[model samples]
Target chain A: MNPANGGWLIALTLVAAMLLGVVHLPETWPGWLGWLRPNWLILVLFFWVIEVPHRVGLIAMWITGLFVDVLYADPVGLNGLILASVSYLGWRFFERLRMYSVLQQCGILFLLVLGAEVLSVMVLGLGSERPWSWHVLVSALVTMLVWPLMFLLLLRLRTGLRVE
Target chain B: MSALLITLESSTRLLDPLRSFIGSLVSPIYVVAESPYLLTNAVGDVLATREQLQQKNRDLERRVLELSQISQQYVALKAENDRLRELLGSQGRLPYEVLIAELVGVIPDPTTFQIIIDKGADAGLSVGQAVLDAEGLFGQVVEVNRFTSRVLLLTDRDHAVPVRINRNGVRSIAGGTGDMGSLVLENVAISADIVEGDRVETSGLGGRFPPGYPVGIVASVVVEPTSAFAEVLVRPSALLDRSRHVLVIFTPQPQIESNDANTDGVVDLDQGEAAPATNGVENAQAGAT
Candidate 1:
């Protein structure tokens, strides 16, 4: 496929991922399960940043973070700052990240996601007086666990569709 | 860090318009995302057995009959109450106008207990309006966008409501503990007339919430001998996690009358009317029990 079509396809996948991230689970789902939900938006952004660092840069990630901020009714620019920093790190190490094994990548992504969670907590703490809890780390771990699956799935799509 | 802090602190003015624009833009995405769950629920209803459907219909009819009977008595009581208020030189309780909205999205982060509804300022919603489910008081609107608004749930740590014990009319402040399914009432004296199983309702002291809506039930009351205050835990009356349909209460703004009798510089006429109504309720409660 042409680079233009490939870019469009990647954008489409990212949009779908974001929708999945925002969709509400059934009310009957237990509260603990909510804490375990992986950060799908971060996972998708990380994937694209690793694969096509030139295409999905800090500006795109920041804008996507703003979208998430609106979706969650959080203070705008909070997620933008978090996502932009993380994306910058991802882009800086994109080549190195691609060379690492999936397991090593998961370890590094864990720290990245953890950093995002901590930064979000700090920012939200500054903006509002919400009590911080340990459950925030749970989502980071869940995101780490889901990384390999997302990586493999996106890799297959990119190869089969001949993206870029 | 200082710049970020300033930006974060001033976001309500600087970022609200942009946020509202983004909110309007993503509203379609929210609707599309919610469609699958809605479709599944619809399919489940369509596939229910005939006997199950019949039972549900019968149950609804019985509930409707019961409510209609209670409403008849309520109308008469309201008229009597109005007459009494007129005699006492107080304005009658203003009726609430409500708009039903569907829960579009919920903040999944456990720390922030908030939900977004499908209505906004365009629909006459304003900040501080009360939100409710079928059971009781749920929360209040803290932010209003163009096409949607966010409700800060009663379970969020930042939320606090002035509540009164239903049995003795003793007042207390119920604050969210940031935990699921619980609130904490602070500063109740050890000898206070509070107990487990006591119903709590909004006291309307701050005028943000309408008075008398059920807020929660006292789950546990712990009195430590060493401590000056008792710790009271409350579980909200509304199904905070489950209800998809909610009502946004629209309280009518007091009319601005320029008549000679109103020449006195009263800033808020509603506040003046509310005080006597509150006292009358307390007296009636005292008399009833």
Candidate 2:
């Protein structure tokens, strides 16, 4: 695949993930269900970084995180740090992560997203004290649960677009 | 790279402009995300029966009539107050200016209870500006970007408002409990005169929020023998979960030089020339609209 098409594909996927990240649930939906929405940005970034380590690297992940931070109105660079760290780890262990089954990868994703969630909360606490909630932990679990579907979806997109 | 950006963002506002710039770049994401909700609303509006539309129109007309009557009374009272102040050689109070803002988004995080409104720094909305629904005080702006801003709702766990009982002037602090339906009064003396059904309004003690806007009503008061403070709960008057339109209020009298310049130009023309009574024509248009 030409480099230009792959790059646009990456951006399109990132924007899609960002939209899902901040999407509001209908009012009839229970409030607690909102926390169950998986952290889509991390999942997509991890998939791209693991599959095409050369194309999606630390800086790309960081920039996408910056966009997410702005979209969520979170402390700027907070999600960038999370994405950078996750991408760095993915880049380091791409071979191992690739060899693992989808279920095993979910375990890894659970841990990765959990760390990202906890780190964001702690950094936010640095400015002002905000109490911790189960959402931080629960969201990671839900993201882990969501990985197989995300993995297959992106897998098809990568192959369908021939995004090498 | 992330560490440096975070450090600069927190230590100084060196990254504030960059933040707003990024916010503007990504502004379309808000529209894309909200398309489903917007389409649903549009469909509902279009699908409403003729009778339903007429009923809604009649209800709105009646509300406007009631509000105009109250405003007329208020204008007369304001004129009398101005005259009395003039006789006493006192300064006149400026009328608070407000801009109508529409809700753009709700924070996805349920526990935080925040929202994004269409008005932002570009609209001169600043952090701590009071936001109100038609019924009562709703919240305050927390973060301002280029075209949108975030508001922490009155029921956010971290939000609190200094309020006074409208029945008597006894003041207390109403703190949110992360519930959409209620707020808790902090450190109310057990002997506090607050009672069930007492009307609560902003006291202007801290001055972040202006005085006299209705905040809530004291729903229940429980006095305990072991505790020094009584537990009082308030039901907010604003529909925190439902209101789509809000008003952001700020004192414009001293803030914008350009607006003052325009007003001055208008006044000069009115005083100096036969300007065809443009001011009266503008006022009539404003009233008709």
Candidate 3:
């Protein structure tokens, strides 16, 4: 497996995640249901950071976060900062995180997603009039629920595609 | 952390070019993502029965005729109104240049009320421009990139509109309650003449939102003798949560000469005259009843 092929695979996966993040739901869907959509980008970033710690670095995560910031119309560098921290944590504990059971990993992922959400709300809420609500927690939960599936799927892609 | 905070606080001008550049780059991702929904809708339209298509066409034709007749009368009234305004030495409201935009994406977080529209600076959209749908005032552009703009909806807790009751023209401030369907009218004295079901319209006082667009309707009025102000809940007229198409209002920059006078007049009329006049009328009506 060559580095070039693996890099392209990673890039393609990230692009797919970005598209998922921006996809619009049907107009008829209730607003409350929107909260259930997981943070697709974060899940993918976490997966890559854990599987290929040497390949996926903090700079890459931060740049992807900037793209997410632009996509979300949030203050530039907000997501970058959040993702930088999350990727740093993942990089630091990749060995242990890899050895943990899927359920334990899910617990940690839940905390990571929740922490990101709280930080985002605190930062973005400073200038805006948005009130902090419990509904944001639903997304963290949804992200946690989606983690195992994302992990397994990415694992297969890496192995099957002979991605180094 | 401090560096991040500083970046967040700075005027986005430092990052505007970069943001816009990347925004244009990723705009197609949004378009492609939205294709499935659009395709389904197109398919649905195509699969509709011939009878259903005929019925819709006939209904639309009848509506067009009815609207044209009303528009014919409105043109005459508009001329008279312009003449009266000139006679009174007051500036007429500027005609707005409106551009239609489609909702490409919505912020999924329920706590935030913002939407990304398909039009941006390329389409002459600028921050703080008022947005509306077919029903009424929707929101305002808070950020404009190259190919997209972000709108903070009327129900965002941080958004407020200067509005007046259509019935009595009593001015008040309507603030978002973080609820999609409602706005709260603030600072109205319990004794004020506002009643349930009164229509709220933009007062055009803030210079941000143009005057006279429908905002909401009073859903409930709760007056507690213990409280200084009445709690007036208003239901937004626009489908803030549903509408896919919105109009960005390009109100020409108002000239200073008449704007200052107009502001002073609004302050006087709203504070000194309109309140007392409405109070008097309400009292007289109460006596008659």
Candidate 4:
């Protein structure tokens, strides 16, 4: 077994990739072209949770989520808590996830993303004075559509990680 | 371990130096990651572009047309310039230290609509300082970091500015409508000369803002005879959607420190007696209205 792989560098790269994934959440393209926002981070997190549940688990997700909170300037710990919960849930359900096909996995991931969106809205609504709108629903839909590509890329990245 | 944990917790305040050292170490990485690009064209490129001179010719034609129109205005301006010499004279000496800052980004979240400026506390920026563009008032400084400050724009619903009608001198306050372009006039009399096109300026009523700085121009008038107040709509003159640069005006106040120190029972009694002079103008206006 090649022991030189899956070090801190790989974990840091995963974090960077996950952070880059969130930029897709805010774009509004022309007409139907706009509906393609992939929940890149969630899909990446899902793949990593299934591949190496120990290395990139709940705590890692929580810290990355906190970084995202600062980067996006949302209420501190809102995304962190949600992302950590999602990672924990994903790891707990990793056995069932391994048996599923891409389509079934996408559907499950879509539901997870939807739940996260709802939780984020709830957190923001509690902290903010502004009225909630239907825009978040669109973002949830975009996250669902982006899942397959993110899942595939993350799966490919995981193949390179030599698990001990 | 429990005793050690308690000691560690107690000494957390002393760890600030360590935290700051770590922060400085990480700050360079952040700066490199987020720094905006500045492009420079060489003189050789300009010489090469001399072949494609049509754009330059077009630009010169536009300038000539603008110059002729400006010349016509200059003659009229030169004649009336002496008549309005006092207004022009006031413009000669701007009262505050105006620092120019470029608007870097607008935070899209409606709940806290803030804009980040290129200037920070390092550029003499402080919280509550006024930000204005060429046309009118823009925002106020809220959060100042080392390299940048966040300004809460006037159109934010939480923002309110004390203003007066230039025509009637009727003092009132305007609040933002969550739309940076519009403002709502609060507590104005039913009968006021706040017509469309009437300019509004900072009244220095609260001393939070400087006097005579243009706030906005009146956009509409909604008068209801049954209501005690008129619904005045005003559009801010600042081209907020397009303006990149703004002037952060620093108005230093000496009275705040004095007010803080003078918080005593005897001071309260003295303040009560002195309140009549301060409230006299507002009370008289309220009574008349």
lDDT of 4 by residue, B122-230 (tens): 6777666778998898877755556666677777665778888888788888777766568878877777767889999888665567777888998988988789989
Find the 10 residues in a row with the least total lDDT in model 4 chain B: B279-288
Q: In candidate 3, what are the lDDT values of residues B235-272, reduced to their tens digit?
A: 99999977889999988863433434565765544433
Candidate 4 accuracy as lDDT: 0.62
- Evaluation by DockQ, superior candidate among 2 and 4: 2
Q: Write model 4 residue lDDT over A20-122, tens digit each, in one string.
A: 4322212223323333445556766677777666656566676666555444445545666767877888788878887888788777877887787677667
- For each predicted model, how many residue pairs clash, with residues at least 3 apart or on different chains? 0, 0, 0, 1
| Chain A TM-score by candidate, in order | 0.92, 0.95, 0.95, 0.78
Reference-based lDDT, residue A38, model 4: 50
Alpha-carbon RMSD, candidate 1: 5.8
Per residue, candidate 3 scores C-alpha lDDT tens digits across A15-110 of: 898888777667677767777889887798888888887777778777877777777767777888878887899899999999999999999989
- Give lDDT tens digits, candidate 2, residues B1-289: 7777776666665676777788778777877777788899999999999999999999999999999999999999999999999999987777788999988787676557878889888899866678999989998777678898878887876677888999999988888788899988888999889999999998865446778899999999999899999999999999888888999998443333343456666545433332112211121111111
Candidate 1 error regions (>4 Å) = B1-12, B256-289
Error of 4 at A70 (Å): 3.1
Docking quality tier of model 4: incorrect
TM-score ranking of the models: 1, 3, 2, 4
Q: Which one wins on lDDT? A: 2
Q: What TM-score does chain B get in every candidate?
A: 0.85, 0.81, 0.83, 0.62
lDDT tens digits by residue: candidate 1, B218-288: 99999999999999999999999889899999877665354345656554554454322211112112111
TM-score of 3: 0.88
Q: Docking quality tier of candidate 1?
A: acceptable
True contacts kept of 2: 0.57
The better-scoring model by lDDT among 2 and 3 is 2
